[model samples]
Target chain A: MRFSEGTHRLHWATAPLRAFVFLIVYFVLLGFPLLLTQTDDGVRLELSAEVAVRFLLVTVPMTAIAVGSGLWAWLALRFRIDGDDLVVETGLLRKRRRSIPISRVQAIDLVRPLVTRVFALAEVRVELAGGEQSEIALRYLGRRSAQQLRAELLARAAGLPGHTPEAPERHLWRVPFGALLGSLVLRLPVLGAALLFFASLVFLVMYAEGGMLAVAVPVLLGLIRAVIAPMVMYANFTVATSPDGIRLRYGLLETRMQTLPPGRVQAVSIVEPMIWKAIGWARVEVTVAGYAGERQALSSTLLPVAPRHVALHLVSQVFPGTHIDAVPLLPASSKAVSVDRADGAGTDDVVFVSRHGWPCRRTDVIAHARAQSVRLTANPLQRLLGLATVHVDAPPGPVQVAASDRDLGEARAIVESTARRAQAARRAGGDPTHWAAR
Target chain B: MAAPPVYRADQAFAPGNGLRWSPNSKRHTWHRLLAAALWAVPVGAVGEFIVWRNGGGPVAAAMWIVAVVLGVVLAGTVAELDRRSLGYAERAEDLIVMHGVFVKRLIVVPYGRMQFVDVTAGLLERWMGIATVRMHTAAAATDATIPGLPAAEAAHLRDRLAQKGEERSMGL
Candidate 1:
């Protein structure tokens, strides 16, 4: 496991974000005196030399700190694999050299941000066998280099290498652009939370101080930008899978990359988000050994928002020979176990007793829970539509199966049953066919 | 039937286990005992800081050590009880380790679930002639660790786990 590829460092793409942080501090420092000035009445203060010296004194250190920190960060990362040893050389004064054997490099992926896509660059991350992180990262490399590194690692592992991944055929599910927009429009909770925050701020200001009524419109405009930002960031989000693994890249400012080993995938989940209830979109993700390059860092997301039927089809295509459709879902039959009741009713893992059922959009914990991020989610519409979904998420390599039970109880039951069945099968010579639902 | 040394030497893998499971290092009596002892160090360190700040009087320092030790010992008893209650397993097709000082755990790591098994010895562990053996299961939470194991024995255990896991995966 060695890296003999052309070596290069991280690009200067993150400068804008660094500058933005600097500007914020600079203005805050500058704003302190202006706020003091407004309290001084109509007289303008003269530009005194003492103030000039104070400003310079602060500015020099502030600039150096900003520049120095960014430089160190940019310099710390040098991702390479020489022969069999994968290298991660980082740090400023005291250098840290961490290396893993090539065989230890389990999974790898290429991440392209929405912006990086335009420039045609990808950040390649190599995941090691142990630890909770990807371990090494090479930021903003040409697509070819990412491909070549992936190939070399796979080949060294005695697995197939040099197989260029053709991007999955897009629009297989064919989710309409208008449908996406409508779902965005229907996401009232987000809009409501934003409006409520703004209104409260205004009410607080008007009733209390009442002075900043002058900058109201500009503040309102800024508020709108904040509201629409997340939707746009994830709007064009999509995933394209290759035979080797799953590759996902999305986001506006912050780009991300995730790669899963086909063998390490313990389980996968096909998620149907609540907002897309009417349109029926589902996303797929595989649970791997180490998780990183994710928006939800603590947890894993296969594809945050994708069409449902397409997701199922994609899963069958990827894993192969597994039941993909509804195969006698036992959960809907009220056979799943319940853990507790909201109001402390039955001692047995009480089935959620709410006849009106649960809030459609919710998350659930798993049998072998990894992070506290274990959740079962559905949208508001999915709630009203009388379909609740539960997924048992194991942190890294839990079974990647989704059983859409009628209620929370059913989901829990199915998961327990599946786990028991899996354990039984493993004991019985680990026959894959043992898992194929009769 | 008495289970064979859950691990063995000279043999690549063994057959005949009905089930396997992997659980993270589950809390044991030893772990509970260790956690209790850890609390005393912090207490002693802070008390040392206080003694240093004041006049370095042997009597005062000795008195502080007794008080801190007593308090930690009392607290540790309760904490150990709590720690013992929580346990987890990395269940697999072949092997399982039941762990818990508190909420008892049975983590089963079957042969197939053991992805990679390694025996590692750090400076101290090496000097002590002990090593840490890790078994990675397919499931994230399903892993097993047998720590403070003699180094020679740890190597034997790692080889056995890997061989058994691989053999089972290959349907041996």
Candidate 2:
């Protein structure tokens, strides 16, 4: 449990197996040319044996050297936490060393691939504030040790006590199995596959061609894969807010533990898919500056599935002044500008809100000060209908939030005023040095 | 509250062109000319060799000569136009960069939003005594790169941008 102690090596048993796997993959790739020569011509087939002998003559000694180096690397690779820094040293000949300040650590993730999972081992990836190249990884630790180190590293990075008295782990929400699986299978992919399968069946009946099997089988396989992957990845999805920060633990096969500190999240969005909307469900996602370097598909997800109200509450946790509830914001009319309405929708300065949807209702809001830029668009159909979409952009993040189908005049006014408000807010709060005093 | 500023797409924010300066005209022209020759020489040689080997007759050989001439002319013209269109302005809190020939693009990067500023020079640029200044923000789309500035000017811009970025990026 003492992470700050002297030095530690990875699980020793996995080293030899990892080295063997690496060699196997290397040989398979190298032997491909020989295989191709044997298939192409008989004269070349004789030369293939000579090539194989020459290859072994060179690679056998090379493999021996590599194995020797691998053993040395296993013995030499060591890590320690000294003061506020995590120091890792490896390589016998080149002798590489890396020291990462805990303060600069943005995220600590635990990944267990299929092979590693069988052995009950995990790999810890530490991402620093510096872009992608700044990542440091420690591979093949026992599952329990990996989890403990992830927590310790995250707490240290966020400048919080590793074990706080008041910091009890509070379970906020866990996605239900039915809802999670429903969200995955109810997407356009299944519908598309169904339509394609029907068309292929009709074509096969008409022409009696064997090509239909080629198309239908692959399409069916892809549909099955798409459904199963997310279902497995989000099987035990859960989110919570601890003193250290927002802690997320999910995945059935390859489990991951992620911590996102306050203020590190640049922007957040609450997305309710068409299918999920009918059931009053939503997903919350965020964008973090540190992890933006390498785009991980599902890294910034705050909540996989939650009720609309619960998702909104989580949004408020990250972005203090924002909410998704219906307030006395401006309401735009269909025909002419409506200043007469008690709650002026086509007016400026009250609140930025856009409401749309028929079977499902969608409302979007962005505080004036937090908006990076505001854009107004009116397609030909919308232009004819006198409606437009207002897109409020914040700093670059994983998720984007926009309000579609509003009165054109109101949309224009809202975007212009929002931009002005953003400029004024930046000017006023130009100095936050005193406020952020640690 | 007063009325907010309304933006019109056609009317861009006009920067102070009088205060802006272009790269050294003579040196830039030579740089583009040399680059065009570098591209033209290899293609011309290959084309001439292919035509000779194929016995494509004198007309085909003449066509290769014309193609090489056209390629050199097109590269040189585009480079000249690109050099003319590129410009940069330094405001109190932001840097504005504008460039493009057919479709104009204007980028405004606030000093507070700047994550880092870098100055780099490739081999040709170094030989020409020029460098490129790149300003990076947390948003990948907001990056602004200005090439063909004197090495000294590029360095000065880098230092000033770093200073302002540090001073302004105090909060978030």
Candidate 3:
């Protein structure tokens, strides 16, 4: 079927709402001048209501003009799906056109602000595969249409034929309230942050005794809020598998739905924080290209908090046919212990899985074909314990999944074997005809 | 046809012929120099204004000038040395980018995993006729880039990389 050539405008209700937002922003900016004025002596002083009234006469018209232009720009904007690409054209004076191929669409996120939610509308944001600031956002779409558009983009990107059987979506897991609260309380970072906050508060109270309660009360509330925010986000977190990819739905006050497609996931990491160690709870996260921009440091959490078995199960889905804890890692009593670390790193085709944690444990696994790079590192304490760490570098993410504290020689061996296996896998998979073709 | 040769799981594998390292264009030196000058302008202007207003004498002025000159020279030398250290090698299945002088870094991006290749140039780079080619892969650690290539070469490389990426991505 041929796609329509004509441009499609946004929902009609968007223009007035957009204009209202513009007016709010303009008035807020204009208020700066309204509240303060420069005196002849060059000192800025607060203005009275009489002066504010005088300023509003000029400010009101300026705001009206700004809103009028913003409405015009919004009206001029139009988008259409042409062939396999989503095309957007905007700007009344200097026209800007963008066409994003459906295949390049990496992720589509649906966000509903309080205002939009009241109107049963949502903002659809589409992220493309490469480039900084590669996002096409359509604000204020009817909730149902927004969801349909998201599904369509995802379906197209996956190259699924129309009328494919609807795979019954299954809920894989949900974050239990008990576990969510435990995760929040047991998080080492939050504890450390709280400690620092109290430490500074005590120091300030002792150093500056004036109005201590005034400062302490707000800061204390802020710290509590900071900790509670993430807890609330994970309160009812749910993971579901669909035809497109994985569906993540969570958040208490605001609901956000993110669809992550297959193969877009760069790396999967399961982190067991120190406090959560005894309970065997871990958080699973994945880094996807373009999601974190060029820095590539931020990771989107797949499971906010889950049991070790559940977390690993979720991770295995990303790396099909790979088991986390089933493989045999080099034991401390291996014969390779006596050999030089470098020499022990002899080739072996088997998958080297490293499981580590004292208070918390994490088992990271990658198929030889999927392994990126392997390195061995030994800290002072680990060296004293005759142990070394094998860090398997995946794509960009905050979590560095590593085999921590193995016998030095065994760690080296694991690194070497992993590298060799990865190379062999690459050759076998990459070159279909092999050397004969060449 | 004979079977494809198979390596023992233990055998060491080296990706490329240990040769043919291509360095970026020398024009990057001028581009870096211009950037350094532009950066120094604001600092120098602000310092001069503050010193003059505070009734500073000739020694302060001279010292500021020396510092500015030293900064520019240091930046230029580092830029040139860094440019020299940057090199890239493209194999059938992967691209390797080697860089850094004191602490070397070698990044290998598999073609099959490459998402896209971006060719970009800033105003200074455009004026100098050089562009930067960035290769995006599934893993952030393996993302490789070649800066200061001639614009034509950069564009050509971009197309070639994209084609190779597509051909190999099929295995994925």
Give the winner by TM-score.
2
Real contacts recovered, all predictions? 0.11, 0.15, 0.14
On DockQ, the leading prediction is 2
A32-66 per-residue lDDT for model 2 (tens digits)? 44433544445343455767687777667757866
Per-residue lDDT of B57-151 in model 2, one digit per residue for the tens?
99999999898898888877888888887777787766767666654444556677677899888788889998889987655555478877888
Interface RMSD for each predicted structure = 16.6, 6.0, 8.2
> In model 2, what is the error at residue A79, expressed in angstroms?
2.3
Native A-B contact fraction in model 2: 0.15
lDDT of 2 at B138: 51
Candidate achieving higher DockQ, 2 or 3: 2
lDDT at residue A92 of model 2 (Cα atoms): 64
Residue range B1-172, candidate 1, lDDT tens digits: 2222322211111121333332222233344445556767887988888898987798889988888777766666755564443322323434434333422222345455456888886655565566677776544444455565567766876787777777756221
The per-prediction tally of clashing pairs is: 61, 2, 3
Task: Give model 3's DockQ, 2 decimals.
Answer: 0.12
Q: Scoring only chain A, what TM-score does candidate 2 earn?
A: 0.72
The C-alpha stretches of model 1 lying farther than 4 A from their native spots are A1-3, A12-77, A91-93, A101-123, A139-177, A184-230, A255-261, A272-286, A292-299, A326-393, A396-438, B1-93, B96-107, B114-172
